[model samples]
Target: MKKETFSRVFPFALFMLFIGLEEFARFLQGKDILQVGTHAIYWIYPVKAVAVGAVLIFFRKHYREMRLGDLGRPTQTVASLLVGLGVFWLWVNMDWSFGTQGAPSGFNPNVFDDTSRTGMTAVRLAGAVLVVPVMEELFWRSFLLRYIIDGKFSRVPIGTFSWASFLATVVLFGLEHNYFLAGMMAGAAFNLLLYYTRSISQCILAHAVANLALGIYVLQTGQWRFW
Candidate 1:
């Protein structure tokens, strides 16, 4: 194969490998295989971030580099604002969906109990703000959506929207979360960011900001039901 073809395929293959390894490890360990919550934020989350960063570095020539400044587009700003409102509206609409479980009976409130000595809360916060945004944006926005349009990802326009790719990814993303509605909204918003700014970094930043705000709100309001 040509060097360009190899470059295009390698990062995506590595991403799939990383995801499979993480999931298989989790299955074998019967819990979070990385033990992310047990380790300090500086140690665990940063290591995961480094792994993602390394992949980007290795594929720097093939992959597009996105930066925060790229998000200055008016459409991107509007989309980001709409994302926030959409999430809040989804929360309100799904209030009954959460039910009245409460505490340890049906749901464990300790997950959001930041006062606890366990590092789970911190780990979750770090993952949301740092790790998740990078990996997810790379996969969902930069790779899968473009890959759906054509094999040559670099040549594919960033804002290209395919109904098939959007729905498929949104469903997959939703299944990853306990709050299905919230996850669906998140997936849509991230895709919209890519569509508006034509920058994966903008989607990454928007995702991180949304998750960080949601995390803080969950802690403050004792809305562990969302978790």
Candidate 2:
């Protein structure tokens, strides 16, 4: 991998590891990672979440080479945001049988719990809203998408298209999520935004909008499974 690819990917790799850490923490304590942990969430999440914070700080300005400027032209920005909303609506409706089975019904903050005890739900909402989009955008669109076209990814233009590479990236992106179908569609939408606007930041904004809506919906309806 190129230096830029490595840099862009490192933080995201840490994030993936952090997910495992969450599971490990829960497993070690005999608690369910998916459920609202009355006490387990307090120490396990905050402590491990610090590692993610550190990784974020380390890569704060690392993707400078990508030039993800101005979040695309005005038209692209509006379109991407609209597409994001559309993705959110579609995401909730489609649950592929091959994808994840819904989580066992569990405690959701709005209904069975609140932010008072652990504040984990609130923290997760913040992450979904703020950090996740930025991290995934740079890794998947700016780096991986272009990286697939060429190892010297920076040489590949932001919007460069290759059918095989694009589809592969979409599949990989889809596999990353619990809902394969929706995730693939979401990936395609974000990838299209990158292709159209030629702006990594636009993809970032689009992803943020989608996740923000998902977070809001999850919080409002006590959809702990989605969280």
Candidate 3:
């Protein structure tokens, strides 16, 4: 892969690697081949977050689309916030039968005592809100969307649209989540946001807003499945 591709793909790949490891460990635990408790798997989230977060920071300079100046006007900021909140509302409601793959064994901090649970919940929420959005937007919108447009993805301007790229990205993004329909809806929304603003920072902000709202909702409703 080119340096550009490596810069964009590595952190997200690392994040997914950790997730795969967690799943494999869970499989072993299920079969009684691994003696570790489920809480041990929970640690993978923060570990991945930190590992990927560090990589993102290291390659921060390479992400031209994420520059501080590209945050857009006040109007665009408001639009991002509104769209984000709207997506969050739709996401929780759209957990219909066909959309769900299975009952998600989501992050449950309740397994720990009060202090550890509190810390674990905080870390999970922080990873969801802050780290995930940036990592995902970089992979999905900034890289794959353009990469599909052209192998030399950096030559393609950010938010350049083609039906093939758009449809493929939306489907792949949906498959990345348990709630496939909701994920597609969000992916489309964010794709359109990129089309409108041509700003990855706004997309990140929108994603962060949606995640923050979902995190709060999960905490309040005790809906660990959403986490």
Candidate 4:
């Protein structure tokens, strides 16, 4: 169990560092070390994406044990997709204008850089839709969700539920995003999905579905704040 725990944990801890890495880039931009516009984002997303890739590679064996191939039943996939979309709907409406501090600004490809606007937007969207969901699911749902419930989390079974683990994951997951309230709502939904399906693959698929919708919505509406 210790070996298995290590197998699941090490990569996830490293993966979470992407948030800090981006914040560091933002700090550099703040200090005038890096340009505010595209220059900062250009380095941020790609580096994080690369880091996610590296973690996957480093833990390839254990990652495989994660049973990514065992995505979920067809019914589970369909239901999760709908849930994902529902979360997106709730997310867009749950802004801070009511009272809360607004979510931190998300990636904005248009005003941020100029060299290759179209290409940069493509990369940004791709990373958000493709890369972010996979990495986050692996760390959050596949590992942290159970790990928080037990030391030998792997034996705990997927969809294992304890109020402590569920709420802890929900709050922490919510805090990860800029939109505190909406993120909290989304976290709740995703956590429920894991509970319902007991499949990391389904959780990943659901998250990917949400991100894809969000990417498209952000692009079409020019709501860069959601990026």
Please report the candidate that would top TM-score against the real structure.
3
> What is candidate 1's local distance difference test score?
0.62
Give candidate 2 regions above 4 Å deviation.
25-50, 65-69, 101-107, 110-118
Better of 1 and 4 by TM-score: 4
TM-score of each: 0.64, 0.83, 0.97, 0.85
Runs off by more than 4 Å, candidate 1: 1-63, 88-120
lDDT digits (tens) for residues 1-227 of candidate 1: 55545554455456556545544554545555445532222233334545655665676666454666776777776676667556655654555555322221112335334554246566557766776666677767777778778877668877789898888777766655556666776787778767777788777777777777777777787775554
lDDT of 3: 0.91
Q: Sort the predicted structures by lDDT, highest score first.
A: 3, 4, 2, 1
lDDT of 1 at 51: 64
By lDDT, who's the top model here?
A: 3
Residue-level lDDT of model 2, residues 143-170, one tens digit each, is 8888788888888887799997789889
Q: What's model 2's overall lDDT?
A: 0.74
Residue 96 error for model 2, in Å? 3.9
Q: Sorted on TM-score, highest at the top, how do the candidates line up? A: 3, 4, 2, 1
Per residue, candidate 4 scores C-alpha lDDT tens digits across 1-227 of 46566656665566567667777777787799976764555566666666666666676677543565556477888988998899888888886665244446576666544666677777777776776777777777777888888866778788888888888888888877777778778878998998888887787788888988988998899887787
Scanning candidate 1 in windows of ten residues, the lowest lDDT window is: 99-108
Residue-pair clash count for candidate 1: 0
